[model samples]
Target: MDKDTGKAFDFRLFKRLMRHTKPYRLTFYGVALAAILLSGFAVATGVIAGDIVNDAISPKDADKLLFLSLLMLAILFAQVLSQLGFNYYANWLGESIIKDVRISLFQKMLGFKMTYFDRSSIGLLVTRAVADMQRIGEIFSQGFFVIVADLLKMLTAAIAMLVLNWRMALIVFALLPIIMIATRLFQKAMKVAFIEVRAQVSNLNSFVQERITGMKIVQLFTREEIEKENFRGINEKHQNAWLKTVWYNSIFFPIAESVSSIAVALMVWFGVLQNVANVGSENTGIIVTFIFLIELLFRPLRQIADKFNTLQMGMVAANRVFKILDTESHIDDLGTVEKEDVKGDISFSDVRFGYIADEEVLHGISFDVKAGETVAIVGATGAGKSTIINLLSRFYEINSGMILVDDIDIKAYKLSSLRDKIAVVLQDVFLFADTIANNISLKNNEVSVADIEQAAKQIGVHEFISSLPGGYQYNVKERGTMLSSGQRQLIAFLRAYVSNPSILVLDEATSSVDTYSEQLIQKATEKITEGRTSIIIAHRLATIKKADKIIVMDAGKIVESGNHKELLKKGGYYSNLYEAQFMAEEVA
Candidate 1:
C-alpha cells in the first residue's frame, strides 16, 4: 500500500518468478529462435517489395522481378509458420509455469502455521491463487513474448536500415533517446499506480468475501444498508485506483506513438534533402525501402511501451504473492527424534504461548494426561480454552517451555506423525461437499461400505442418514449446508472415530446439537474414547460432569481441577460457576 517506499519494485521477486520457467527452457529458446527468423523474414519482404517496384517501373528483367516476388512469398509463409509455432510453445510454457507456481504456492500455504490463516483473509488468499496467477500468466504469455520479439525486431530493423542508408538511419535513431527517457520517467509512476491498484483489489475482495460469509450476522443485526455502504466505499476506491492506472497508460502510449511518428517523419525529410543536394539519386525504390524499414523499427518500439505496462502490473501482483510466500512459519517440524507409535501420554511443563509476543495468552501452565484418560478443560470464553488444544496439536508453538508426548518433546517428532495420532472435532464442524460415506472415510479410498455404515451406526447417525433419500451416498452441499447443525456434528464425530486415532479431542462437540442429539453424542463419545486418551474443551458444564478429571480455567490458568464431586465439594470458582448455571436452569 505504501507505494512511495523506494523498495516498491523488487528485482529479487522478479528473479523468483523467473525460476518457475526453468521447466520450460526449451520452449523459451524455441520461441526466441522463431522470433529471430520471423523478424528476418519481415525485413526481407520490404527489400523484395522495393526491388519489384524498381524492376516493374523501369521495365527491367521480368525473371529477376518474378524471383524477388516468389522469394517474398516464401519468406512471408515461413514467417507465418514460425509465428504459429512460437505462439503454441509460448502459450504452453506460460500456462505450465503458472500451474507449477500455483501448486507450489498452495503447498507452501498449507505448510504455514495456523496463525497465518488467523491473520489473513480467505478472500485475499484466494485472489492470490486465482486472479493474481492469471495476471502473471498474461505477463509471461503476451508481455514477455512481445518484449522479446520487439527487442529483436527493433535491433534487426535498425541494423538493416543503417546498412541501406546510414544517413537516414541516423536521423531516425536520434529519437531513441526520447523513448528511453520517457520510459525511465514512466516506470516509477506506473509501478506506483499498479501497486495502488493491487492493494485496492485486495481490500475489495476481502470486504466482499467477509460480508458474504457473514451475511447471516448482517441480517440478524439489520445492518444490510450499513454493509452495503461499506462495500460501496471499498469498490469506489478500487475503481479510482484503476482509473489512475488507465490515465497513465493512456498518456504513455500516445506519447510513445508521437515520438515514433516524429522519428519516421525526420527520416523521410532527410532522405528528400539528400536527394535534392545530389548526395544520392531520387530513386523511388530506395526511398520506399527506407520508409518501410523505418516503420518496422518504430513498430516494435511502440510494442515495447505497451508490454512495459503489463510488466508493471505483473510486478505488483508478484510482490504481493512473494510477500506471502516469504513469511517464515513460527511452528516447524524439528527432526530430533521419530516415534513410530505414541502411547497418547501428554505433559506440558512451564508452557507459555501467545499470538503476539509480550502478550501471553497461556501462562507458565503445566498439566499431564496419562494414556487412556479423559481430561476436560472448561473456562469462560477467551480464557484460552481453545488455545490449550491448539498447542497440544502443535497448531502453534509454545514460547518458553516444552510439551511432551509420551515423555518426548513434540518438536522432536515429525509433524505429520505427531498429528496422525490425534483427531479433533471442533465446535464448528466443516464438511466437504461430498457423499456422507466419502467424508467419513476421508483418508482411505478403499474403505468398505459396511465399515462406513458401522461407523455411522456407532455414532447414532446411521438411522437418520438411512432416512435420507440417498443414505450414505447423500451429497452434502457446501460446508454441509444441506444438513442440520446436529447432523453435521454427528458426521464430524463419525469422521474422527473412523480415523481410529490414539487420542481424541472434542472441543464443544455437542454444544450446537439439540438435547436428543447431545445425548446421542455423549453415548458416541463414550464408545470412541474407550481405551484412548481424550481431551474435551467445553462450555456446557453438563458435558464434562462425568469426565475422569475436570480442570477449571480462568484468566489463562487452571483455577481448580478435580473430579465432578470433588470440585463441587471444594466450593471454589468451579462451584460458584456450577451453582450459577444450576440456578439459571432451575429458573428456566
Candidate 2:
C-alpha cells in the first residue's frame, strides 16, 4: 500500500476490487435499493412535518394531526426495515468477499517458490492476510456503501428544499462549499494517516510474532529488556499514526457543525426578513421543515469524512493485497507429463543456481545416483548440498542446466507427480500441533493410520511411539516442541518412510541427536532405504561409510567421488576431511 500513487482513487484498482463482488451483484443491488428507499424516507419525513405544521396544527385540526403522525410512524418503520436489510447484507457481503480474498492469498503463497519466502517475513504476511483483509471488508460494511446511502439521503433532502422554496434552498446550498472543502482536506489527510497506520501495524505484527516465536532465544541470551525497548518504539509509532487521523477529525468535525448551524441560522434570518419587509407572509412550516432538511443535508457531510477514512484504509489494504495477487514468484507448472512413479534414477547436469541474482550458490555441479543405490553427499556448510536437494525437488528452478529423474527432465513431470515420488527429511524437522499420525501422513487420507504404524514399525520407531501416552494419536504441539530434537527427527523419518517414495533424502538427519537416538535413526534409515534410492547428506563421516558411492564437495564443486576405502586411498579432500573431522570416532 504505497502512499505516493498520485491518484488517491485509482480507477483501475477500484475496478479490480469491484470484480470480486461480481458474484454478489444481487447484494449490491439490494444495498442500492436501500439507499434509494432511505433517500425517499428522508424526503417524506420533511414533507410530513411541513404538512403537520401548515395543514393540521395551524388549522387546529386534531384528526389531521393524528393521521399525519401515524403516517410518519409508518415511514419510520419502513426506513428501519430498509436500514436493517442494508446493514445485514452489506456486512455479509464484506465477510464473503474477505473469505475469498484470504483463500486466494493462501493459495498463492502455497504455490510460491521457496526463494520468495526466504526474504519475506512470516508476521508481515499474516498481517496482510488477516488484518489488512479485514480493512477491505470494512469498505462495504462501514465505508463505501454507507457513504453512498447517506449521500443519497442528502441529495433527496436538497431536492425537497428546492421544490418547497427555491430562494431558501439557495441559502442552505450556499453553505455546502465550505463543508465540502473541509471534507476534501480531511479525506486527503486521512488517506496519508491510514497508510502510515497500516505500515506501523505490519511492523508491529512482524516484531511481535518474531519475538514470540523465538522467545526461547530471547530468554536464553537475556535480550528481553532490549526487545521490550524495541517494542515500545514500535508501539509508540503505531499510536502516533492512529492519532494523526484523530487529530484531523478533531479539526474537521467542528468546521462542518459550525457551517451547518450557520446555514440554519441564515434560513431563520431570511424568514424574519420576509416578515419585517412584508415581502411574504411568515411560513413557520417551511422553516421547521427546512430545519429537518438542513440536518439531513449537513449531517452526512459531517460524518462523510470519517467514513472516508474507512474507505481510505480499504483502498490501502487493496493495494497491498493486490500486490501479492499480482506477484509472479510462483513456480510455473509447465510440464505436461504425469507419472504414478519413477525408476529412482536422479542426475544434475551442469546445474547452476542462486537464491539471489548474480550470487551463485551452486556452480554448475554435476552428480548422478543410480536406482536403488544409496549415495551420500558430503560437504561443508556452504558447499550447496541442501541447494542440490532443493533443486531436485523443484523447490527452485535451475539457472542454466537440467535435473533429471529416470533419464527424463524433472521439469517434464508435473509438480505434484514429481513431488509425490520423492520424500525429504531435513535437519530442522517441522511438525504441526496435531496428532502424530496426522503429522506423519500430513492429512493425506490415502495413507491410513495403519499404513503409518506399519511404516513406523519398519523404521523401528513403532515401540518408541507406543511408549507415548497417546501413541500414534499424541499431539506434537507447535514445531514438535514437546519432543526432543532427536524424537522430532524420528517423526520426520517416519513421515518420509510412509510415503513409500521412490527417492528419499535425509539432509543431516542425524546431526543433532543423542547416541541412542542416532542408533535408532541409523537403524530406521537402513530399513527405509532398503529398496528406494536414498541420498544422505551428513557431516559425520562414519554415517555414510556403507554408502554404495560417496561424493565429496568443497565450496560449490565436487572434489572427489568414490567409496570410503578408495577416497581414503586417494589421500584427497575426503581423506583429509575424515582425518580432521572423524579421527576421534575412528580412534574410539
TM-scores vs. true structure, each candidate? 0.95, 0.98
Clashing pairs in 2: none
- Candidate no. 2 TM-score: 0.98
User: What lDDT tens digits, residue by residue, belong to model 2 across residues 451-568?
Assistant: 9988888789999999998999999899998899999999999999888899999999999799989999999999999988999999998899999999998888889999999999
305-407 in candidate 1: lDDT tens per residue?
Answer: 6676787677777777777778897577775565666789989898888889799998888888999999999889988888988998889888889999998
Q: Every model's Cα RMSD, please?
A: 2.1, 1.5
Sequence-dependent TM-score of model 1: 0.95
Q: What is the C-alpha local distance difference test score of each model?
A: 0.82, 0.90
- Lowest summed-lDDT stretch of 10 residues in model 1? 1-10
Residue 328 accuracy (lDDT) in model 1? 91
